[model samples]
Target: MISFHNEGGIMYRFIFLLFLSFQTNAADFVHPYPSFSEGEKLYTFPDFLNAHYYISYDSENKSASIKAEISFKTEEEGYPLFDLKENPTRVELDGKEIETPLVDSPKKETKFRVMNQLTSIGVHTLRVEVPLKFLLRYTDKGVDSAFWLADLDDRSFLENYIPSSFENDSVEMIFDVSFKISADQQIFANGEIERTGDRDFRITFPKEYTSSSVYYHTTPLGSFNERRFEIKSKVSGKVIPVIVYSKTISNFNSYEESIRQTMDELEADYGPYLHSSFIVYDADLSRWGLGGMEYCGATVTNLWAVQHELFHSFFGRGVMAANGNSGWIDEALASWRDGGYFSNQNMRERRALVLDFPYVKKTNRLAYSYGKNFISFLDGNTKMPIEMKLFMKSLYQKKSWTPITTEDLIVELDLFSGNSYQQLFDEYVYGNKSTLDASELWIEPNSSEHSIHRKISGEDLYKIL
Candidate 1:
């Protein structure tokens, strides 16, 4: 996390980074992503597309083989594009030589596979045409990628492709995945892995996954165990099971205690956590980034970034704001929760940030100013709590499980708070107003300076303002 302060004592900002680290042991796979089930069909969008993969690993040669199951919905018949790295040796499609197109200036691997002439639609099988070593090289970033073989030291298949879109109206598909690894190495995936042999395991997706990318990490650092939490929601009409992937097994540990507290607070405040599992990784800071990215039912976060990222389960992944502008709502709300709702420490740090950093001139006030101001306004306004609930509900009503824009949120705020958000926007967001008038609330100042500095408790601040 980075803190900025300004000499003018006008504005303060704390900019946080996505921390990365390497896992020391196998952590229980926690669903950092949102997931849901429709009828007997389970569905989630981890990224943008629906992907199913079968992977096998060979310990003797440090290699792996993969078969992908893919399905895309279109009004007309068309084939999906399979752009791959150049190292694959044997290429086949249902056991035949398929001509691969070579494009100039390939991003990673120079080759691409296109089934431009598919005779059928729905489910299609994509078998590897080349050797496993080539696919491994591509997934491992030429074997020199950072965090390669950090924990498991075994060969694995990882999907790195981005999905076309993340809308909620898309169709869902299931993944039937199986993997073979060395007897000594452990494997993890989206769902539970059922072992069939000493060297092979299979993972079945109980729901339709969203992302086109699948990730596999091979390390030798620590061990993992599976745990389940049943979440009964008052808002949604489902009992979601939350999976926890924790490196620590003991409940008395501080890490576990922190997680429990955070979970309790978040569940009490936000809606139920809608995932089968969540992963708590005891990883080194240099490997995976600071916080975890939300996957349908899985999230990857190091210990340091857990609380902040967990809060994101509600703000970022659950009620996703629109792209490019939603970063403010997602990040700032998470930061506020992590910092304990602008407690004394938070206020001190925020005051310092204003007095020490360059926040007044920042162009992206949506992220820095609007986020902080909304939090502060919520602290001050008596109607804020109910208004916030209504605001979130309005977002769901308007967007219907899709990402929404800031303008959408502003309208929702107007409806709930009975005040034009444009006025607040002009005063705080565009005009850069920080401190509210203490006189309006009948608060007496002990001393007057260029800026007012006082210790305000979270509860007192809420009541006073």
Candidate 2:
């Protein structure tokens, strides 16, 4: 939907140069721009084909040794750039060591560009040795931080500490992680974990075709309870490994059953579950305001909120949006799946909330509420229930790991509903024009039975709404 054609202006000419620099042959390159204010700065994205990360952690010193090898193909005539927070100790291009690691500092960016040496346009591999310092913060059980390693009567990590490339599309990234800790420590990764020695361990994840990020948790031995189970896919007859990590072992079986049921319902509504495994971490977040967040195939939340985060596997992380503005595409679908809106009246309230704040750029209340309401209108009023299912499955299959824009979603909606979503989108979504006519939007009130099919408690539902 984004065009970088020749235009007679300095801005257009600069953009054209950036387009040339961001070329990729892996797939048709779709630039995800025209986002919020920060959108204009993101002129390029990595067409990441494959990557391998070797991480070594020293719990005693809180330092890390990270070595990464990334293979990608781009049609850009100039050097490829990467966003790395820490400076690498060594850099290599296509198995040859460059005399100096070319680091270009553009104005007003937290990221430094890794200059590439591409003599010709083809597949090339870049290797770098990244030194991580104090990336781990020690905290107590009450603290709810993304990446924390703590010794609160026990030493453990909250995972999500691994430094990741910014906004890269999903690809087959092989990870080989090694951790050195106390003799009685255990490492929990999002990948298949294996114990190689007394104080050494390795976790290798399968190629994630539906996720753009990878993460893991490391803890002292026996610090947390672990339960391993499996869920059967009726569509593929494949059984997937499921792991639960909780501070206590109480009611783990019930949690597993709930997770299984949620997966079953989602797989039935959508297609088969995309990942080979799923993990739930019932983390103690008594202090942090936020309760839950979703990772690639793993989640950090309480036992009761497992379904909400699991649904994210199909929406948030499974099918990525282009930017924060398009984040509603995932958040709204996930909220609807969680029964955030149950009736046409509730949909009206959601629309009113969006109309109240028409120009908020970042993902906030408007994104979730309006998103759920819009989908509810389509499914309940327009009565495209069957097409809705097909559209979701097809969209998921096509844009599994790639980021899609609002325009991209409108195209899909138009194809499914056989109607234009421009007016609705402009009013409620992209443009925030606030000129949508609700009387013309609704077709009929949904049946009471269909309208009140909420699963969560009224109290929790109200909180989300």
Candidate 3:
């Protein structure tokens, strides 16, 4: 993992490129990403249209109550399965109370309960009320945890923390989410906010969203200093609100320019920014571990990490990979774009550094690096004259706010570049039987050239020109 370094009280972001010469065996490492088997049949399910969410929490407490109204259309006279992480206290369909039926002897991979309800072949509405409470725990240093907090300063990660529909599937959802907190506390969400009452704050996502991408955060009113501004796109003249909140007032202004540049460049490269507002939460340096994480229209990170996560608003969370199988696609594309490695030399250098990393089921950092190398090769190498912008723009236009698979992306690649990537996946991405030196991805140094190439181990060489 990359560590945050502070020199002379100034934050310096460093990306670790080299692996240890003597490291633990791969089998000993704890894999971060989970692989689900077919036995876990109760995964994300149910296709819904719109939802109205009302969440109320107290900053001094660890529990919150949520009430949701969901609307869906059934294809036939069959029950639709709803996957919920939390248990529902009450369920009503079409203004009538209904029993919450549970599937018996569900698949072994099912982590949460699945509800199957019979319905007619027409539009139906359901109201669900679920009460959620997270165990409050402190870190090793005795400070409050960011994931679940109720103290002097507070923030709740409501994406998975709150009760919602399936997370992976792509469904058109219009959200009307409101929050009720202390009157003195300030809240920020994905949409426009209105002060409903002295202690109630409501945020409505009027536009259609690809998934249940609703996210909001709250802190004490005066806990942090904030800077609010707006930027208009030259391509579409669409304006977006940008806000940066931080504990210290030193570097929040610098992020405005960085955000504007990133937004403008991405809009020109991909399409438009889909969300209404952008928020950057500069948590304390002690919360560095929580930083660099992305939400729908908000992120919690330092200035440099802002651009990478913001770009995810276009790629990773923006395009919405169908499942964990294709999650690397967006991360790889984001890293490649952030690295600005658009030339053969840049691709070669990146490939040399990341060739040994595992491309399949690797930790997020290594997976991201390996992905960066793979997309860099496809986008920058002269052997494949694929225009990165055109390919991405086409993908964005077609799969915006939708879930996609690796096979689906490969088909698009063949259509655009007239080349098949099945072999590429078999060798690197999906297969792990061969090392970098034995694979065809390595660019061997020329013997006639006077360049110095350092050999790491066996046939592995780090080419230098």
Q: How far is candidate 2 from the true structure (C-alpha RMSD, Å)?
A: 10.2
Question: How high is the CA lDDT of each candidate model?
Answer: 0.38, 0.54, 0.53
Q: After superposition, how far is residue 305 of candidate 2 from its true place, in Å?
A: 1.7
For candidate 3, give the lDDT of residue 8: 24
TM-score of each: 0.52, 0.69, 0.67
**Per-residue lDDT of model 3, residues 92-161, tens digit only:** 8878777665442232222333334455544678788876444322222221112221100111123234
Ranking by lDDT: 2, 3, 1
Better of 1 and 2 by lDDT: 2
Error of 3 at 429 (Å): 2.6
lDDT of model number 1 = 0.38
Higher-TM-score candidate among 2 and 3? 2
The root-mean-square deviation over C-alpha atoms between each candidate and the true structure, in angstroms, is: 18.1, 10.2, 17.0
